[model samples]
Target chain A: MGLAVILCLITWFVLVNSRKMAPLPVSPTSAMVLVPPPTLTPLPTPTIYVSPTPTQRPGLPPASGGIQVGGYVQITGTSGAGLRLRSGAGLEFDPKFLGMDSEVFEVKEGPVEANGITWWYLVAPYDESRSGWAASNYLQIVTTQP
Target chain B: MDIRPAEITANRANSIVTIQWNDGHRSAYPFGLLRAACPCASCRGGHENMSAEPDAEVFSTVLPESPATRIRSVEAAGSYAIIIEWEDGHHYGIYNWHYLRALCPCEECRSRFGEAV
Candidate 1:
């Protein structure tokens, strides 16, 4: 009888525990609600980045080149974009006068050597005009100093 | 280094300023040019945008006559710069010798000192 009673009690305990609706005990540190595992998103990464010109060569290149001093010349290499007229020779000169396209100028003096590029000194062909230095690579010779 | 102006004459009627450099070069600037190339913090869009030379766009702009474009007076700011007072009560742009020389808009200066990219 005693053994039977013990078996019945053990069965009752198992049934009651299985039927319980309470959640598992949580510690204060783990009171946060359980979250599903997150899905990772991919990010884009660039493979190459090349600079158009060197950035470390401090200072500007001096004005250089332009044999047809005092001659008429046409602004070229504007490539549908405006050509920069610098205050001095070199790509890094300072404060541009304007970005003009196909503008004509009278060569003055130059053929200076700066930053491995040839430049020319030019004057405004007209009385109400501007004078400055420009890259020879962008200039097309129209005539000798006239 | 001898780029100092031997003489500076302001023609109020003509609204022009004639600067005769010691080297014998004469530059005549219109009052509009001065207003366009003003080096003041407000005129240049702020102090951080300030440069040793004028902006290339200054050549393309046509500033209309007004108190802002009218020169009230021109004062020497030491040997290096000149302080220009405008009739509009704005007198902040200080034109230094180096800056003034570089800002010359003549074709010679334009070609020789094209804006540094």
Candidate 2:
């Protein structure tokens, strides 16, 4: 008799909890009103990046042909004859000065093509007036010793 | 080296000017380029702004088609330079051989000078 009473109470408790847990029925119109609207996201804009000429990197050895516009370079491959620095970028321009072998210079301008030769404008660090265009064949990048 | 022009010809039909240098190199300049590269003090902004080289900006500047860009005539100034007269009555630019050669608008010249057109 006591066991039968315990089983009946357990059944009663389950039925009561189930009724509380069950979801309430709703109409389609009510469901739509309760739901939030979908959101729209905009796309990101695209960007264009232009590569710089004579690109440089950190902690790396200078390029063999790194005679850049703002970098330093040394005269080479001219033997002892010296490289002729011209008033302009072409071979036709008058020679402004003669750059000796291994003389260091700062690149001021040029990569101008003339007479089928590549020319660069170099300026002596010691003398600004001693500047002119020299062939790229006789130039080498000057790298700092670490 | 002294550079001089062996010949200069204007093709109004093509709106191009050709200069054959004594060094055997030839430079072809557009009418607008010659006007934009005018070495006159006024065109250059001031007398102090005059330079042996053409301003690097001229290679990319595209002036509108007008009287300023039309070449009325090209005259030799002594033996060293040439004066260009424009249809707009502006004829003060004296382009020397050095300046003209430097102003060459070839792929080689533009690339070496770090400019674009």
Candidate 3:
């Protein structure tokens, strides 16, 4: 039993003394050699975003290219109020019409005739319910053909 | 002022929507006010809270001139409602005639339905 106690005391003493021993001091240059050099990688360039300008479509006349169906057209030169959009082509149609100048419309279908005047079918760019025929003379094409 | 509009016109430059009723009552609403008064459940918070009237607070909620409030189109939904499309392609709200009538911000309607009648 005493031999066993001696073995345990020797083991504890060896462990505690070994733990208390200080680590060998290394030079600063040798400690730095253990560290990895930092890599200076280039950062990714940020992309610039450009927002598109709102196109005031369906109003202005084409500069050079001729206007086509599915393009935009504006109401212009209507004395005081604006151009009349009719259920069909002709003055015989209703005269009471909503006229907002500079408003644009999609050319739905047309090149039809009535009462000696040419009319173009239009779908109101703002109000689809206002789709009707407007006399071609009042139309001014705005954007490129769509 | 609880009448259907005989003619509806919007002045984009002025950001105003003028509605002339059959009874000669004219209501000119600011686009910002109307946008806030959108009757969709999303605008009203939830479908359960959706009612026949626009919220009184909507009259004071004026949105800016971004696509969120920019009017792209005004489409009639049959004889009862109007669906307005904004520049951002949001066209869900359907403003019915009765709702619009009740939403009138005129002096007459204000007395009829309080602050934002």
lDDT of 2 at B19: 75
Q: Which of 1 and 2 is the better model by TM-score? A: 1
TM-score of each: 0.45, 0.43, 0.44
Off by over 4 Å in 1: A1-146, B115-117
- Chain A TM-scores for all candidates read 0.49, 0.55, 0.52
Candidate number 3, chain A TM-score = 0.52
Cα RMSD to the true fold for all candidates:
22.1, 25.1, 20.4
DockQ result, candidate 3: 0.02
Q: State model 1's lDDT.
A: 0.64
Model 3 chain A: which ten-residue window has the lowest total lDDT?
A43-52
Can you tell me which runs of candidate 2 are displaced by over 4 Å?
A: A1-146, B111-117
For model 2, which pairs clash? A111-B112, A112-B112
Comparing 2 and 3 on lDDT, the stronger one: 2
Evaluated at residue A14, the lDDT of candidate 2 is: 96
- Alpha-carbon error at B116 in model 1, in Å? 10
True contacts kept of 3: 0.00
- Report residue A39 deviation for candidate 3 (angstroms): 84
